[model samples]
Target: MIEVNFDGIVGPTHNYAGLSIGNRASFANAGAVSSPRLAALQGVGKMRRMLAMGLGQGVFLPHVRPNTDWLRTLGFNGSDTETLASAWMSDRALVANAMSASAMWTANAATVSPAPDTRDGLCHLSVANLSTMPHRASEAGQTERQLRLAFPDPRFFRIHAPLPAAFGDEGAANFMRIAPRSGGPAVEMFVYGEGQSGGFPSRQHRTASEAVARRHGLSPARSLVVRQSDAAIAAGAFHNDVVAVANGHVLFAHEAAFADPAALYAALAALVPDVVTIEVPADRVSLDTAIRTYLFNSQLVTMPDGGMTLVLPGEAQENAAVWAWLNELIAQGGPIDRLEVVDVRESMRNGGGPACLRLRVQVDADALAAIDPRFLLNETVCARLEQVITQEWPESIAPEELGDPRLWDRCARARSALTEALGFGTDEL
Candidate 1:
């Protein structure tokens, strides 16, 4: 079996409009000019870094943005140009929702269960019905179509439609799995948030978590549902990935991440053997600092060696407390032995870190070989993608420019060129 990290390519329309309610970074950087070219290349560069580290790396192409279909659904009528102008004049918020580029953060793409963990012994994936945020809710249908296109063999992989909007499933960002090894006996952890009266929004509802687990056919004995702290949510941890991350047997989380930390850890210990729980104390790294630096949002990946490595965003290094905690964790390492930091400031400012960019999909060797080869990234593929991004992607994008007719043309050109280069047919995108 092999674990492949599928990283989403940042879209050409990426901008900050203060869209996400509970994301502090998005709010802080609202109305700032964004570099679409830099964002896409930076994400691809991270993919290349993962490949260089001898890890399996795959790429998910960005969906068509400035989605005219969405605008039409919002009751805007006329030619694409007229519709955009009318929508801009009528409701800028609706225009913003239609033009969202949040699909780059594929951590919320879907909830995937490996073949070994599923009831039918076939890998299962449920596209996230991101109903909490209007911008993100539009991604569900396109994401599901893309997943099915990528893995066409239904016998090996099963793709489930998004749950009803009432469930509000946010996908893999709130879900984690710990296996004894790569192949079997995978214990799944589903983390949810209580959407109560609070300063911040709780995106992951408890009922949504339960619905996803049942839809995915996860084993009850090996599955657990834990609650995210109300304090953490109010502190701007919109999703659980902001405060907790797990890989294999290691779980790196903040002290205030969960409502019942002791019970969760004890249950994990009971489910999986030799589970390593690395909890960063609030004193060592305050919740405010953790949310700010995205220290715990780092991806804890099991390296080629038996040990693990932490893939962190550059912001973590800039913060003194988070940086010190990193050093301490490395010094006292058992599972995690190395730290690798990458610059993703473009995505970081929009509240996405290294872990937020990728989805962890485990597939057996044969199933892995069956995957679409065009999506796999190596040195040559990475270079070609970078060249395309540099030439085709716009250097910068402003919020007001989203209504420009030229923007759609340029985005279409870039997306078309990318899909053609990737050998993906029309249905694939």
Candidate 2:
């Protein structure tokens, strides 16, 4: 068995429009110029690194932003130019929301249940409705198609629709899985920020978490629903992945990550003995500092050698508190033994980190083999993707450029090239 990571490639429409209201980095870098080409390459570079580590890696195609379907839904009519003009004239912010390349963050793509954990003995994936935010809400439809195409065997894989809009599901970004061993029985943890938040909008609703557990056929005994701390959410931890991460038996989290950290650990310990809980107190690394450095968002991966590796963004290395804490953690010789920091500055500026970019799936050899071959990261595929990004992706994009008559053609061409390169259909983007 292996933990296959399906990473979303940053789309050509990548820009900092300050679309995510609570995302601190997004707001801070709102009007800054964005590099879509660099973003895509950075993601591919991470995929390459995962492959180099003898880990399973796959890629999710980007969402085609400036989406005509979304524009149509918003009542824009007539020719492409006419629709673009009308949308921009009516509400520039709506245009920015529709043109968000946020689909690249696959952690929010779906809530997945491995075959071992599901009642039917088949892997179940529920696409997130993302009903809380306009920008993210548009992703459910395309993500469903992508999942179906990737796992075509109905007998082995069941892809379920997103929960109702009222439920406000935000997918795996708020979900975590922990197992005794790589192929052992698992405990599913669903973390939801409360509704009616005082500071940031709580993205994941509690009802939505329960609905997903039911939809996935996960028993109550094997699942735990945890509330995310309002303080963490207030400090720009928009998603639970931003505050806590888990791999195998280890749960690395900030003390303020959950409303009841002790209860979470005790529940997990009840299911699996010797569960390792590495808690970083607020005093040691302030919540503000943690959000700035994305310390918790780093990918905690189990290596082939039985040790864990922290795949972090370059931003982590630049933060003094985060860097010092990492060194100390390794010096103590815990589960995490190595660290691989990669330059994902483009994504970092937009408030996504290494873990935010990938959806982790636990699968056996057969399920892993069934994934689309073209989407797998190998030397040749990685090279081809980088080439397509270099030639077709825009070097820089401004929020205003989303309405440019010329921008659609550029974005379309890039999407087409990527779809072709990745063996996806015309509808993929």
**How does each model score on lDDT?**
0.88, 0.88
Clashing pairs counted in every model: 0, 0
In model 2, the runs with Cα more than 4 Å from the true position are: 182-184, 427-429
lDDT of 1 by residue, 196-304 (tens): 5267767777887887778778888988999999989988888899999999988889999999999999998888867888899999999999999898778888788
Q: How many backbone clashes does candidate 2 have?
A: 0
TM-score of 2: 0.97
Per-residue accuracy of model 2 over 202-243 as CA lDDT, tens digit each = 999999999989888998998999999999888899999999
What shift in Å separates residue 382 of candidate 2 from its native position after superposition?
0.4
- lDDT score of residue 85 within candidate 2: 78
Which pairs of residues have clashing backbones in candidate 1?
none
